[model samples]
Structure formats: C-alpha cells, structure tokens
Target: MKALIRSSAAVSAFILALSSSGVLIAQAATTGTTTTPTPMTSTATSDLTAGPLTLTAVPSFDFGTATLTGTTGDKVPGSSVTGALKVTNPGQIGGWQVTVAGTPFTDTSGTALTGTILSLDGLATNPITADDSTNTSTLPTFVTPETISTSATVVESAAPSTSTSHIGIGSYTTSYDAAASSLAVPSSTVAGTYTSTLTWTMSNAPA
Candidate 1:
C-alpha cells in the first residue's frame, strides 16, 4: 500500500510541471510586437513673366486755316499746332524710336499744292523726373520747312532705362507748324479747302 501511494504522487507532480511549461511557451509565442515605416515629401517653383510692348498716338495735328493775301509766286506762313504721343513698354529690354511722314497737301480737285512746306519741332517728354542715359543731348531739330516727301523722318528716340528694371510709360509732345507758298498762281486759283494726312510709326530699334 505505501509503494502504490508513492507512485501516484510522483505521476501527479510530473503532470503539473508539464502543464505549467506548456502554458509559459504559449504566452511567450504571443508576446512579440511589430511596426511599419512612414513616408515623406516636398515641391518646387518660379516667378511670373511680363507681356509685350505697346504704343499709341492722340489728337491729330491741325495747322488751322490760312488766308493767302500774297500775290502769285508768293509764300505764306500758317499758324502752328501742337499735339501729344504716348509710348508704353511692358517688358522691353532695349531702346525705342518714333518717326513721322505725311503726304502732300492737295485741294479737293487732287491738285498738289506747289511750294507747300511742313515743319516739326519742339520735341518734349513727360515724367522727366528720372534721367535716362540713352536720351539725346538735344531733342530732334527740324528748322527748315520740308516739303512732303515719300521718306519718313525720325522725330524722337530714347534709350533703355538705367534707373528702372522696365520702362513703364513715356510721353512725347511736339509742335507742328506749316507754310504754303504760291509757286505760280494760276490765272484761276481754285477756291476750296486743302487737306493732308500724317502717319506716325514706333519701332523697337533705337535711332
């Protein structure tokens, strides 16, 4: 009876130890941890650009009316007229120039008036507040009254702005004066009005 009881006690102790070892192994297998990596990012950029250059003219030049009291082959002078012209440059890096040309004055009959002369002078620019290095020392000068020719004449010119990065706006005001002389008064001088047209051109090229 004592030997059987000792055998039963030893078997029970071995079973309990095996059960505890199994439980510990199972808990250890489930105790591990895990983790994942995160992502990262960024961007790039630039500046806005400028637009094209532009030019405009206003107020047609009018020499006004004239009365011819002189005799045949005589020359008569007419009153002078004044007007303004504007130039706008947005993104131009270089300089600019302006020119003008006109057709001959003619009567309603399309008869080209002989000895007709037109003169342009007194060129002035506005916003003289800033100094431009490229400007001419003297403004354009047209002393002699020139007859209407096919070729155009340069009236004004300005260089690239040294003070500002870009030329914003520039204005030119000029005086127009004219004179008419009778080369040979016909036996019958027509009685009517005379008219002519003047065209102005602006160029990116400097004068």
Candidate 2:
C-alpha cells in the first residue's frame, strides 16, 4: 500500500532498474515526521443530590443609640444596618415561609418603651442571582411594612412545588428600606441605653 507524505520535507522517487519478476523497482526518500490519526474519547458524569431548603442569611437590625429631649416626641433617630434577608431553595417539593418577631425596646434599667414600635417599610423581593437564565416569577412572595411584634408574623412565603412545577426553586432576597425605625419617648421616659431583640424564623409552609 502507498501513503501520501504529509510533512514539511520533500519526497522523491527514482526508477532504479527492473526486477527479476519483470517489475519496475523504485527508490524513494522522505524526510520529517509522518502522522497518523488516532481517535480518543472522554466520559464524565455527575449526580446532583438534593440540597437543604432553608434560610441562608438574615440581617441583624441595629436601631443604634438615641437621645431623648425631655418631652414627648413621636420618634427618634437611630443607626442603620446594611443588609437584605436571604433564603435558598433546594428544589424541594414543598413550600416555605419566614416569620419575624421582636421584643419590646427596653433600657439598661429595664424601662420599656411602652408605645414604641419597630417597622420596616418599602418591603419587596429582589433578584437573588444575576443569571440570565433565572426565572423572575419564581421569587418568593412577601408582606410589606411589617411592625414586627411579639407574635410570629409571616413576612415572606412561597407556594408548594410539584413533581413537574416549581414555585420557589431558587435563592431569594428581600429588600427593605428604613422608613421610620425609631423609638418613641414619652415625657416620663428615663434617659439611658436601650436595646431590643428580633427573632427571625424559617419553616416549611404550603400555599
């Protein structure tokens, strides 16, 4: 069999003489490398196990320190914490919800801010991921302007998912603005450092 030389060298063939069997004999010289193709295949596989459907991050509220003017005032200014409430879904076949409750604001001396309330306004859902393939409709639902109290109130929720459909199958984030996050001080309020505790809970909840 004859094969073509595929290299950067010149090939030459010269007729030398005739063979004893009445066949023409030739001499050939070739330089450089000859290449032959060999096929190669690669295989790879992966199994995606289920991940936990839960809250990934919860923002800490810091209404900071406030000073009282020796008289009755509606609200007082305080510091702010920068963050957003975050939740993640593991493609679970169930729904989920997040609730928030807060204890009354009190001073170091246990003096409660009786009529004071902590509120978050301009509440809304934000896109958790910037992936172009993410579906915007699957983000979680939320209730806005929450005046977090002692009772657990649902702030964000998601509908149940089925075998073929998903309501909240991706990560979600809730954005809230500081509208009026201050404590009210009455004329009788004792001037001192005050603090409050906020509790955020996540659980499995269906539509």
Best by TM-score: 2
Range of the 10 consecutive residues with the lowest summed lDDT in candidate 1 = 178-187
* Top model number, lDDT: 2
Model 1 over residues 1-207: C-alpha lDDT tens digits?
999999999999999999999999999888967778787677677765645555555335455554555555433344544444555444455666666776766888898665555554333322222224554333322222334344676655656644544342333334443332112223344545767687777777754
Cα RMSD for predicted model 1:
11.9
Give lDDT: candidate 1, residue 19: 99
List per-candidate RMSD values in Å. Answer: 11.9, 11.3
| Error at 154, model 1, angstroms | 0.7
Clashes (backbone N, CA, C under 3 Å), per candidate, total 0, 0
Prediction 1 TM-score vs. true: 0.50
- Displacement of residue 104 (Cα, Å) in model 2 is 1.9
Give candidate 2's root-mean-square deviation (CA, Å). 11.3
